[model samples]
Target: MTDSGLEFDLTRRIGGFILRGRASLPACGIVSVSGSSGAGKTSLLRAIAGLDSGLSGQVRFAGETWHDGTCRMPVHRRRIGIAFQDTRLFPHQSVAGNLAYGAARAPAGTPGPDRAEIIALLDLHPLLKRAVAGLSGGERQRVSLGRALLSRPRLLLLDEPLSAVDTARRNRLLPDLRQLLLDHGIPALHVSHSRAEIAQLADHVLPVRDGQCGACHPLNDWLAAQDASHPFSLLEGHLAGHDTENGLSTVRLGEASLVLPGLGEVPAGASLRLIVRARDVALALDPVPGLSIRNQIPVRIKGIRPQPGTAYCDLDLALDGQVLTARITRAAADSLSLETGQSVIALIKSATLDPAQE
Candidate 1:
């Protein structure tokens, strides 16, 4: 996950709403653009693709300038491919036909996309002969991705690609999407409001807020900072192991074993970050016996801090070198005799950890 080999600084004012942001994307893997609704996420993507005209600023790719405040490049001239939430594949075409459309439209002298490679990369061989209208939501998305790949664009933009699918459908298609971006070495700009989508797929996080581009960090750090409005903490670890049949994984955090929902094909030792909401964790003075809950990490209370208007107090736990924040009612803290330096066990469930927190 490196930069997109491009630099962008653009500003477009549409009436009272204005979108002003800048980013330096690496040449490899995926970069995510995230923010609350109406925060210019979509407009930014459109501007880069040349779909939104009148955008002023610089859009530089490689060493060539694409968009300067004074000059605008037409959409067809830019070597960028985009896949929107609708995935508008031609209704009369088959899966293969749709992909071929992209190949046919590719610029002359450009290295045409290998049909076999596109088919295999997206696992679309099974549906090649199927009618486009008959495809499932996940299947449609895969075909859409294949079509985009066949276009041989220098940069790919995905706008909330998974928002239309149900959870089961998303899970079914995620592995293919991951391989498409990683195995194929495709540089992409992905836009989404869903934290989980950004967490699992993006390495570089670009947070857009109030029509401005803020600091960029690894996906995990960005998510942790989001839940500060409530009592929650962020933790990052390696994907130690997974039980596909059960859809769970044993996550390694320092010396502790934290099992959570399995992220498909997350290679062993792959870094995984989780958001542990304050309400999901329980504190115990001593280890309880015969518990089905999986996470029971030894914690030493650091201190308690008060949040305005809330009856609960934020408890800081020293788990290895990382601090875990927990929100508990002040009454519960006093009843359990919890205080600074008190030895305790933090109880958590594998189901409670949100993958998007990463």
Candidate 2:
């Protein structure tokens, strides 16, 4: 896994914009490239896949050399499969025909991917005979993925695969993509601007900024560092049990139970990533009984940092030693007489945590 997944050192100048970035992607799973608009994410993908001829850099995947300036490979010769946000399927072709387009591209003598495998991976079985133009947005995107996988690519490059669909459809298709990466062990370079997409799909994250590739970091930790105004904390735990009567899922953070509501149909023993916002956490002196908050973990106040008009308190929950931050007004802090070395309960609602399948 430490082997460099993808590398680029070329530069391209487009009018007033200079697109240049160097990064090393992991050798397995999804290595996500993220940035603001106009940060050259798509251009970078094209450069890596040999689709952009205007760039100058050595692009290498595994031990194979792709571009070395003098000898430039054509797109068709790259053996790389690319799937964009748009399905770009042939309007006149049937779904099977569209998929066969990629299937036909496999190298001579190599067995192509099975139709059922592609269909099951992307849930495209029902629409196998449907016309490309008749499929819905999500279905078309799934078919596009199937076509790309059937191409038998050495590397798969996806540029905002879910961006073209509506939010609801995007949510529906993400899990399928996740299963593809995990179950099939296909390595991918997934480009996106959405944090949630990266959280759900990426096992390794490469954050691109200012036309330069930065160091790799874990997806959750990198997301927490994005904003200083409202820093976030991450808790990684397994779904220990379910409380169906309360509509809450119990996450086992060491020995404590974190009850969050609206956890829709997650299987037991699945890893859960919980996001506890600083503003949503509250501190208490003793275990109160009359409050609506269900969590009352015994924690020690670690440190209290004060701002101009408010104060930020950091607490270390005993369970897994997870950190919980509470932003309170200066007056509120004074009223509670909060201080370091004090004991409190970290109040949290189940709705605040994102119940995603890891």
Candidate 3:
């Protein structure tokens, strides 16, 4: 089969740090680049975009050789749309002017959203005529994103795109950003430090550690490898129905079902992704009655991992072939004598379930 994704084995040296980035990322969907400060995350991105002249080794995208032992492609020739943390908008131009410039430079027959669609999607209609110098940090980032989208490049690279936006605004924009990528079939490499962003936006995770970028992993596997403090699992389902009276929504996942906070605005039968935190799940030996918790799923114990020197243990559960995690005190595990293959009830409070656009 022909390889249809990004493949790179790059090396660069910045000051005293030697950076190595190596990965084979999918051709579609969002891939999050995660790492700490000074870990070469930005450097890796610059190298891929052909901005790092000192970069050495191979870089290929969808069978196209961007960089090789002796040949190198120019940045513009690579046809990538990039939004940096600095929000590199043209200072002298109005918001609309910057957006128009991007549109004008788009290569003929490039496939993506049109100018009107992008302006509405990013809520840029109101700020179209405003000068770039007068915009707020969040507004600047939004404009930067709008410009990039208008270009309709084959690949998108975002470096902390939403960092300047407030939590509430960021939460609302994330879904729209994800939908845009999916709708246009634009593959992206998103660099973010926010766990919520990763959970909501990432289809695959590329970890940068100790100045090296690692191979991409599925979202579930990446979450499993995280520490207890970041224990989260993703569940995919379709919205089955909604109860307007009680303000709740029902989602169908295979043979299993879940009750979540009212998502009435979302049409019935729409696909949804649910984020469940391990700490919010309670385990019980038997089904309890008359509880406020809305979801009581019958799951079989798959495995147990005890956190050393900590009071808690993470239980891997199987519910109709889907995996759910529960974190409870070690004492509770001993008292219940939980064992592999034992069937138990997993209690989840409906309010704690966060639904994301899929």
Candidate 3 Cα lDDT to native: 0.84
> Each model's C-alpha lDDT?
0.76, 0.72, 0.84
Most accurate candidate by TM-score: 3
**lDDT per residue (tens digit) for residues 249-289 in model 3:** 89887888888874665556755567777887899999899
lDDT sort, best first: 3, 1, 2
Worst 10 residues of 1 by lDDT: 349-358
When sorted by TM-score, best at the front, the candidate numbers are: 3, 2, 1
TM-score per model over all chains: 0.71, 0.77, 0.81
Per lDDT, the best of the predicted structures is 3
The clash tally of candidate 3 reads: 0
Better of 1 and 2 by lDDT: 1
Least lDDT summed over 10 consecutive residues: which range in candidate 3? 349-358
Per-residue lDDT over 19-120 for candidate 2, one digit per residue giving the tens place of the 0 to 100 score: 877776777778888888888888788888877667887887776678886778777887888888787889999999999998998887755456677787
How many residue pairs clash in all the candidates, one count each?
9, 3, 0
Worst 10 residues of 2 by lDDT: 349-358
